[model samples]
Target: MDGDYVIGGVFSIHYYMHTVKHNYTTMPEPLSCTGSIDSRELRFSRTMVFAIEQINNSTELLPGIKLGYEIYDSCASVSVAVHVAFQLSGGLDPVFNTGDKCSQSGMVMAVVGESGSTPSISMLRVIGPFNIPQVSHFATCACLSDKQHYPSFFRTIPSDQFQADALAKLVKHFGWTWIGAVQSDSDYGNNGMASFLHAARKEGICVEYSESFSRTHPRSRIQRVADVIRRSTAKVVVAFTSTGDMRILLEELSRKPSPPRQWIGSESWVTDPDMLRFSFLAGAIGFGIEKSVIPGLRDFLLDLSPSKVADSPLLTMFWEEAFNCRLVKSFQ
Candidate 1:
């Protein structure tokens, strides 16, 4: 999409990256991220496009100015995010010199995402120095709220510090003195779990075990965490993890015989509608962000088709999986 000014978007449209182990012999292969598309995050990207179109059609908003976008898939990787941030924030330097520092440059007026807190932080380190504003929809780490560290960073969701306190209180209310803890090994989970642990100590709660994992963790690592949960005596488990990491852990747990225990989750995984597929998690509990209805966003998302999305391989892959059909490409 093209316009007078561009709004850069970063989303975890894919859940995992197929990590390439380099031998450092010749040239390193291109980075490849492989995973099923996240429909919810995909909707977020589409909503950005839809909103821009609406603003372009309006006479009151921005008047004669038109806005465009250059949305990138983070694939939930901090390294990939940093790469894209450079692409969006780069190119501000004048190609030719006019003996003047002033010039019309910069790829985007502002950036609209980087859903995960870790990736957001990586992106901010790159673009924040340039004073580019980055508004996140899901990055909720309490560390990001620091003005000195993240001067140009902002988020729509409440900080995990508040959620951590609330979760600790919830456990105390139930008198679950002995519990197991789990978290993603990223900025969001580490910071959130640290807060929860501090609060839990004040409440005189004792944890039996604390484990961490990520979506990119090896199968053996995921199995080890699941085994810890299975063998633990604690009847309650508090999980401060992202949706992607939680899904990977849960999928591994579901494959083997496991004990029944109470599951407490963070807002990151708790609010995901896709988690409903795990019937064992029927009693899971967690907090959620406030919800609101958008007038025509649903229609715009539902109106997608193969023909319309053919040029976009990411969208085409999603459409194929969703409709359970393959699309044939015609060659000239």
Candidate 2:
């Protein structure tokens, strides 16, 4: 999406990256990321494109100026995210000495992503120094609210502190004085769970257990968490996990018969439609962002074709998965 001004988008469209084994003998090959595509994150990227198109078409907004975008997949890696931030900030481009007095600037006027808090933090370290404004849609780590550190950072989602307080209040209201806690082992989950624990203590709540895990952790680690969940005497479980980690844990817990317990979720995974497949998650409660109906947005999203997405490998993959067919390129 090219225009007079470009907005850079950083999204974790892929849930994981291939583990690279380096022999330390030669330069490692380019990083290869292999993982299941995250359809929700894909939608967010398309929505960025859609909104840019709408703004470009509008006669009143920005008047004659055209808005463009450059979207990149972070592949859920902090290193990759930092690399992308540098790219967006023009830090990776080679400088050529042209006989001009004017200074060079990056192609992107601003950035609009890095969906998770840890990745956002990594990106901020790269772009924040350059004074490039970055806004996140889902990164809710409470530490990001420090203006003294992330001066050019902003977000559409509320900080985790508020959500933690709400979750603690919800538990106290339900008389669940004792509960088990699980969190993703990252900035988002770790910081969020810390806030929730602090709030819970103030409300006279006690946690029976607190465990953390990442999606990339070994199966045995995830199983251990599930085993703890199964053995805990607390009837209510508070989970501050991302969708990926939650899915892994649910898969482990569903392997055999297990006692049913009330589940409390964070906004990161609470409203995910994919979690519905786990029957044990019935009656789970959590907070979510308010939903809004955007006029004509549904039609815009549906207006797609093989030809339209031919240039984008990501879109082509998504199309093939959606239609259950392989797309071949014709030389003619």
Candidate 3:
């Protein structure tokens, strides 16, 4: 009511004020009306699976859209990431003022966090129409089979079988006649330890001592692991644990000089950043995916992408969103 109101041919400020007051007491809050868009970050893993799909679709225009969906690997490792943001306000008139909106939300990535110990018995268990990406490496030693909820699962990390075999190799490399293994109490540890024991027996490797520590043992599990290492006559020890956890365990194990001139870990300790974090881990070796080894794949992706060209702005976005940061590829 900018000083202009009329009632019965007379200026009516009172009438306008009454109307405003009525509105002040009648309307709903503003947060309800503003909730429109919902976004999710689907993990496509670092590779531009989305870009590949786009290219495949574009090529279709040439009478040679021939491959349909077959030309490209539709293997997209999709996991849902959900985040919500909103604003809310309290007002006497039930009206939204200039910054009255309130919102809150969370995001979750569908990527599997550590479950990879289960054995995927066969290949091609299903021929579903939806494309599934192969998980060559898994982040955790948790057995995937126990979940029972997801049958079509794969991991990027080697299984307990692989780690067991590798641990034996490492022990042999050190020329250690006796070895010790400390594994977590969870499925990851149990399975990993069992595998190591089996492999050592098969390879004629003497496992002088083996111990298990509960991942949730309330106490310093790392200290327990260290205790096993000390009591054993083994000159080499195998530790199966997460990178961050392993660092702590190593620090504890290093507290006092002991036998086993070398400490070997599974692929869990192999990331470049993790290796560089502690100088003491300089000589640590583990099975890890060397992206450089697949420079060809990176090169091919770059060549096909006008955006990912040398010094291109898209290159930063691509790498940032893919490596470490997680791939949330939305053209927007």
Candidate 4:
């Protein structure tokens, strides 16, 4: 195990179920840890683990060295992500001391994760001092591209800056000069929307209104934004938000007696199957990361066993989803 390297990962496996009444004061219940399961995000986590196993088994990669990993669910909360980042950086205590170095051998060499940019930004600040490398699989906030501020950050996906430019260009090509904008209230949505707005302004596109809301925001706030969208004269609505945020907004929009307008999506929800359920967004279009097939990923997922299920809490959740049964003894 001397040659082993541990990679840290952060993912928003679970989301908060209850409304966030007090954004700063109220602490969510512990049971909120296991909210609605996002199977697609779970698949992303599984793919990462599968890739690590494949690398360990290959003679061409790492040769005699073994790669191990520790994955944490961020729950799509910055606070949760900060705690996990500290643990990954060997700062288990509440206080972070910059003087302390990660104990050499057991220190995480790198981190791959954090599906959203908000959590990634929060984790990056904590892990940056340790000089640990963080490579994100899904984070796309343009702010993360600043090497001067976040020197240790990298990503597998393109930056939101590029996506912003592309989106602006697409709108221009369609001759849509006026539009409405909606964004999630996190770094990913905030920064990405900022970039898009800047680009759109340069393209002479006038936004009728730009509204922002968080996933944990009260239903009334979400409804207010939906009301704005319903009343806006802009025919095109550019939605820069996560699938979770969009889910809430869509629910509110579905309640309204308004007609469907042209919807422009961000990479976050364009490909999400959940969004497909909204027939109102039938003509929605957005940029997506290039799709690629993983050779044995399907078989690996299909070949899950009880032993494998025992190794991961998330896998148990997956099993429950796949087989439509509860594993708890009480349910049994």
Candidate 5:
């Protein structure tokens, strides 16, 4: 925490957590708290720390100026993300009343992420007027390219417009004119699916049906979407969805005996190790961003010790999940 400039970060450290009854009669309570740690997102958050450490150690980058950071968990929810944004801006509580301002001596100069586009957009509204730059590592919604609206927002990944074009071209190459589309019910999915629909129309492709679902939605709604997918005659399905959203639908599909259809994946779940467990997605193809290996990232992650990171509540949660062990405190 000793540095000239503090970089803020927001990541979806946990996946969506909800329960459903066998008959799906009653609605479950809303997600009122953060869930368990998502190991995939933990890697990205760790990489951010690694990058900052690398820069701080470099003699040429800052010339004796040390870099530090304050990272928060977004939980992949807009409400949670907004609360974290206020904390990053030095708010005393989650509530955002008028006349509130950052009173911290060393304020953050920039923020690194909120992972998904919806959470990023929510955080932008809270921090944009302050002129704090937010650089997202994974948010890819096409709407964020608007300089007038999100002037302080930036991302390392390509926009969804480019991915939509690639998906359209790939479908056309295979001579698949009729297809079905499924996307997450968030800014990323809505905007990306809209762009893909426009691109698909221009390419002379016909979409048989388009459906969307969210993690917090009722189980019956997700079941309806699954039923639509099963009844559809389209042999090709373009899924522009997050891992959490897709997992719900996949679980529903697994219950019924159905033929495997060609699935075109989005970057969100294409390389996800959890998604690969579905045998039905074996032949699925999708677009992924270029990959590069950081020199010491692997060793750094493997060397994480509980004692070294015991002070960090976030890292403590990560340690419990990663190792399935609990630590004892003196007070306890």
Candidate 6:
């Protein structure tokens, strides 16, 4: 904003509304990797602070009750602005603490957009591993109770820890002898892969190779993962990347004369209507995936609202964004 306005913090139970008046810089950093996303030339601020602020503006532009807002200056990177905000938060408390950055625990909802580094479902602890929004939900899994707090921190997604156990059971059931491991470079990826490895190894399952991809770098994400599958001693490859990244890898693998010995996709690997527009992940597999679950998860997610009509900016952004993309194709 302009000069001095006291906003120690911000608090909105379900709706996130903020009037951000700050300078945002417009500079593009483009990178490529084999991961799900091909290449995005995002303004540096969009990743963290800028992204939150944009969502805030979008919330303003698009009014909603369940919106998470991030405020920032127009001329700064998300990291720089966040560091400044964190230091700033020490002296004063905000009116709202979206998920992280403030200790006032009540209930916070984390929107899983880009399962970039790890599957959003994999790592949920916002405070521990990554100190990101994911942990806010995880914190609820601990001894603390959100019932006691006003703006409690809660995660709606199923946990990867739980997913890992289910997947490991599936692996054992199928008698899969070996698996290759691929992950995005983030807490979700790291933790999920670790869980996968632990589960498989406990069952005497062999991990062929473990590889990680950078979210910001897409150039080699696909190729390296496919290459690992092609050349590795293992058969199935466990992935922590998003469906977008999975689509790319699967499409590229389909292109190869040879293919992975067998494919084991995370639950994140699912079909969306817009995913097919790019025509990447077709022919990757038929409708044969072992299902995983979190007990009471579906009910829990559905229970987020007393009715289906409860407005959510984050959900609107998600489906709107998804609707804008191409759905996953069955074949070329």
Model 5, runs deviating above 4 Å: 17-33, 91-104, 309-313, 319-332
Model 6: ten consecutive residues of lowest lDDT = 8-17
- CA lDDT of each prediction against the hidden true structure: 0.90, 0.89, 0.42, 0.85, 0.85, 0.43
Order of candidates by TM-score, top first?
2, 1, 4, 5, 3, 6
Q: How many backbone clashes does candidate 6 have?
A: 57
Deviating ranges (above 4 Å) for candidate 3: 1-136, 139-150, 156-158, 214-216, 254-260, 290-332
Kindly report which residue stretches of model 1 are placed more than 4 angstroms away from their true locations once superposed: 23-26, 92-104, 329-332
In candidate 6, what are the lDDT values of residues 276-325, reduced to their tens digit? Answer: 54343343332223446644444533443312312543333333443574
In TM-score terms, which candidate is top?
A: 2
Clash tally, candidates in order: 0, 0, 26, 0, 0, 57
Angstrom error of the Cα, residue 129, model 1: value is: 0.8
1-332 per-residue lDDT for model 1 (tens digits): 87889899999999877777889898987666787999999999999999999999999998999898889999999888998899888853346456567543555889999999999999999999888899999999999999999999988889999999999999999999999999999999999999999999999999999998987777999999999999999999999999999999999999995888899999989889999999889899988888999999889988866577787898899988888988876666
Tens digit of per-residue lDDT, candidate 3, span 86-198: 00001113344456655211111112221223212111122111222223344344455433544445555545676668777777666766767766554556777787777
Per-candidate TM vs. native? 0.94, 0.95, 0.48, 0.88, 0.87, 0.45
- Put down candidate 2 lDDT per residue, 1-332, tens digits, no spaces: 66778899999898787787899999977655677788899999989988999999999999889987889999888888987887888732367546667554434788999899999999999888878899999999999999999999999999999999999999999999999999999999999999999999999999999999999889989999999999989999999999888988999999974798999999989988889999999999999998899987889888877677787899889888878889876667
Model 1: lDDT of residue 218: 79
Best by lDDT: 1
Model with the higher TM-score, candidate 1 or 3: 1
What is the C-alpha lDDT profile of model 4 across 122-175, one tens digit per residue? 998999988999999899998899999999999989999999999999999999
Kindly report the root-mean-square deviation of model 1 from the true structure over all alpha carbons: 2.1
Off by over 4 Å in 4: 1-3, 17-32, 91-102, 328-332
